[model samples]
Target: MDRRFNKHEKLKSKKLINKLFTEGQTVSAYPLRLVYLPTSLNEANTPVKTGVSVSKRYFKKAVQRIRIKRLMREAYRLNKSTYFNNLTTPHAFMILYIGNKKPTYLQMEQAMNKLFNKFINATHKATSDEKNT
Candidate 1:
């Protein structure tokens, strides 16, 4: 894979976004919360599609919100391979930055790692339960 965060990898469809938020499962690690739905929304070649959001209610300024989102996306892009390699199905994810104050990249990266681990575990468990039944 290219390991690049490109336009095709971005989750932008309004309909898909609505379904992702409404029907998805949530996982949180401190400042970050991920809402994900396991479905094949992306093309056959792309295994996952992701969206990032930082609340204006918390950041107030557009610059602050954009900065936080940048950090979040960078963290996720670097660490997403681990998630994709282990997945049994494609997932649409919305990563929400919920912190009230600004956070450093290291802090956000750690939180992103934790969130991904939690998500992987949850998906693994769900698949195993399905196999047993």
Candidate 2:
């Protein structure tokens, strides 16, 4: 697997970001809130871009914040392909960590996958409802 996620793959549109936070479906798992946008550009060359962050308010120690950010990035990298394959359309996301303590790499990845699946299911349900309406 290519370890690089290019610029286009990253979700960078301000409008999309606003929509994601305001109108997008959100799924939470203790340390993570998976906020996703459902529209995407459908092209094979488009690479997925991702951004990782740790809140300093929750983690005062710089070391702790860095470690959590690293773990989050690794988790996203590993499970990203799964997310890519599962995309119903082009989507944007931010995986915010809400837990107090940092978790192991495996733990983060598992949480990510679980949260993503939930997000996808929610998206599907919403779409179905819209179709019926």
Candidate 3:
């Protein structure tokens, strides 16, 4: 199983993030803002790069921030394989935690999974509708 989501593949550039926020489709599942754009990487067989951000104000202590980020990352790593398998095109994904307080790993993981499932279903429906039309 491919388990690495490299930095270069990640939507890390600030400019891209800004553009996506401004123009990309958005779905809010509380704590998670899923911003996605339909695009592809040049590399052959590359999984879409994803980034996760937690608000600093919500997590004042570095330890809390790190813990949340780690939980988010692990959840994404485990659940993202299903997303990759189902997606027909390459896309950029951003998982933004927009909560006002730190959450436990289990809480964050559940939220992330819910957000991801919604995104995948919506995207797939959109793609299928477009193809049918």
Highest lDDT model number: 1
The per-model lDDT (C-alpha) reads 0.88, 0.73, 0.77
Prediction 1 TM-score vs. true:
0.95
Q: Report the lDDT of model 3 for residue 40.
A: 58
Summing lDDT over every window of 10 consecutive residues in candidate 3, give the lowest-scoring window: 1-10
lDDT of 1 by residue, 1-133 (tens): 5568888889999999999988999999988999999887648777889999998788888999989989999998898876676566778999998889899999999999999999888888888899999
Regions more than 4 Å wrong, model 1: none
User: Which is the better candidate, 2 or 3, if ranked by lDDT?
Assistant: 3
**TM-score order of candidates, best first?**
1, 3, 2
lDDT of 1 at 36: 94
Candidate topping TM-score: 1
lDDT-based ranking, best first?
Answer: 1, 3, 2
Tell me which residue pairs clash in candidate 2: 9-47, 9-48, 9-49, 10-49, 31-98, 39-90, 40-90
Give per-residue CA lDDT, model 3, range 61-128, as digits (tens): 88877777788888788777766775667777787888887778788878988898788788878978
Clash pairs for candidate 3: none
RMSD of each: 1.1, 2.8, 2.0
| TM-score, one value per model | 0.95, 0.78, 0.85
Better model by TM-score: candidate 2 vs candidate 3 = 3
